[model samples]
Target: MISLKPRWRSTLEKHRAKSARTERSGSVRLRIVAWTFLLTSFIITGLIFTVREILISDVGRGANSSTESEIGEFRNFAQIGVNPQTARPFETLEDMLGSYVTRQYTGYKEQVIGLTPHQIIFLEEQDHYALTTGYRLHQDQALLTGLRENPSNSGIEQTPAGPVHWGKVAVELRTDQGTTTGHLLVLEYIQPELDAVQHTVFIMIWVGVAGLAFTLLVSWLIATQITKPIRNLRQVAEHINDKNFSGRVTVKGDDDVAAMSHTFNKMLDRLEEATLTERQFMDEVSHELRTPITIVRGHLELMERTEEQEQTLLLVDDELERMGRIVSDLLTLAKSERPDFVQPHPTEVSELMISLDSKVQVFANHRWIIADIAEGEVGLDEQRITQAMLQLAANAAQYSPSGSAITIGSEFYGQGGERQLKLWVQDRGPGVSPEDASILFERFRRNNAKNPATAKQHSMGAGLGLAIVRSIAEAHGGGVWIAAPEDGPGSIFGISLPAPSPPKKTQSITATYPPQNEPEKS
Candidate 1:
């Protein structure tokens, strides 16, 4: 036997397990959302970088145009060997070049100013360069190489120098400043603005990447926090959905989730109370209906002979009688649920059996093999006991094979004077399954479809006969059960009612039932 407390605990434990499962699921969803946000950040960063690259290339090209003009003037001075100090056009040119570099650098700061030293070197090395006065300006040497190697790498061709890298521009100028035509030592190169922009691009990429990672981490945590409660609510709801209404979530705070939990628990309480009330009402209603039906049946039977309509009235009376019986059985089931339903009285077992034998004989086409009715007395409600036996007899007679015997028997059961009264109705009909037997006594339950129609046609208690039988027996502190007989064909339905205290040990009178050839009992 299982303990009731453990069963209750098991139910709660299952809900906790389910809650844990939901928490895990929430964590997984949070991870997915976090990853999605992180990926989006990366994509956006890439797009920004691409757009800035294009803009820088365009700006660099414009700056390169001015730088090229300045370089031409410097070259004209160099060709004439006129010092830059005395070169008038060259002096204007030098100032223009310096201003252009400074302006370009300042403008680029608005987009990507935090270029690392390594990135600056990498950017400058993208091109080729030439030194002024045959001496390399350490700061400008890298620019010479970059201009020679990466003409178009700067996203512009405003200068003409070396490789066709984007944004690159280069210019060839005459070394003689005053000379209109002279040998122009090709000393053109890319501007430092292109190198600065590339360096800034690298620095911005790192910063954006770090920011994206931090954003993703925060987003994941937030998503997890939000969805955790939702998942808990889902799991608890599922438990209730599965009929485990005792479960409740832990209300952490006065958030929406807590409010929802409170509401859910309240709903469960109402549902439980309503369910109990409805069951009580049904029981009371079913029980009350029986008394009126019985009274109606008795009244209808009394009116049977007095009606003057003869045969038609008789048929109507029969139908009315069937309906009355069905209602009475339904009421009996209801009554069984009451605390006062059990009202046992002293009744001789022998006398009850004799009465039952005679009554059931009217419905039997085959003989009833009734065991000797012991002369002992037991406590039982006389009317209810009779009703139960009649239902059993009716069931056997209606469903059994033609002329098959129904054995009604009683025997002593239990040890140490724990007396039990056993009454069984056995028939050689198809047996019910173990699973079906569990619910055989439920109201409106039919064993199979075949008999439901027949029972309806006969108005035979609305399929509640067996249910009433079980209910009555249980009300008398007993249980009824059905199973296949081990001896061979058919089913055996039996009730084991508590025997009367101080059981009478009297002898019984056996009643033998021989085989019958007639269609009806005589």
Candidate 2:
């Protein structure tokens, strides 16, 4: 059982009692934009940091390579390099060092210092000061003393020129006459490269900020476009009510959003139809029963003798029975909308039809025949399908001429996935017109005369029989329709069901008519 809880009446009243308010927009589009901007900003920051680290590392490595290269070049030069001016071995180590410094090139904020046990000397800016930070390193006694004391010569150190990578080599000036020992120092300034990396990172931060702003704006626009339709739907739904189901969502394209709008529109259509149906149902019922009810009441009140009273009572009983049948059919139609309306099982179609042919004969006096039997087992609600077929048979009996052949059978029609098992009743009667046939299964439609009525008198039914048949068929995932008469002046009422898969049992097929008074159950 479903729990029944009505919506808050106070909430509804409050909505109806108030006017719409204009407030700041609390839309999801902005939130998405904000998140996108934040996430992208973080990623940009990470990249900036990563790039800075990599560049700084590369700068450091370049400094080391410059220092090592300078030292290596000096070592080789001291051993073989001669003064280009003289084209001879230098008389002293200082001359060799000075000559080498004049010819060698140095990088940015880099310098070469030649030191001896007797004197400390270096290159000045006029010659190469731009590479030396213009610092008179030879005059910095403390740094010189520290370098002399420090045995390590291949690492960065805090010299007077700031942190610099420096390598020192002790070389023997191999002359044609003798050898002179001297110390050569290569100093590479790392500050300029570090500053360059910092500058690049600073520029990246500003670019990232600008790009983040652009991304935020673009994302906001896209999200707004995506949510516009949803907002429209919500606005329409807010004012929609049971009495007014006229709100239809606007569909713009063949996309998921359009599909959603179309589906919602369809739901509203069904709701409106159901509401109108319920509203008119009682009025129609009252109209149908009014005359019979008034006649029964009049007869009961005016009866004067025992014989007259008996006749009035019989007429009253017949009216009551008719009312009962109408009520029963209405109830059946209502129940058919429920999920449990049909209990389906595997059934042998041929045998079921043979059995139905027998029961059909008992509905009315007619030449009943088994036209065909679909030879297969199928999944269906046997009782409900039988009820629908019997209703069709009854319609035939009441509409066609007495003793006119009424054929009933099941056969397969259609192809592939659209295949169906069709159960039909064909009778020779004043067949329904094409336009009238369209609505024959709707409520309160009387059939073409059943079993040929007397020329002057034709009894009209409650008109719910075909409707009940339709309900039964629909409950089993099937449908009922009238086929255009192939033969003259007759109607073919068909109940179409979806074809079922292979059955568990393979039974032999047989087609035969049942006895008029009795339908043998399979």
- Candidate 1 lDDT, 152-257, residue by residue in tens: 4343323333222223223233334532221111222334545656677777778777777777777777777876876787777776632235677666789877
Model 1 residue 304 distance off true place after TM-score fit, in angstroms: 7.8
Q: Compare the candidates by lDDT and give the number of the best one.
A: 2
Global local distance difference test of model 1: 0.59
Per residue, candidate 2 scores C-alpha lDDT tens digits across 333-381 of 6566556889988888998998897898686668998877788867889
lDDT of each: 0.59, 0.73
RMSD of each: 18.3, 19.5
How many clashing residue pairs appear in each of the predictions shown? 42, 12
Best by the TM-score measure: 2
C-alpha TM-score for every candidate: 0.39, 0.49
Off by over 4 Å in 2: 1-26, 105-108, 126-138, 159-162, 174-180, 282-522
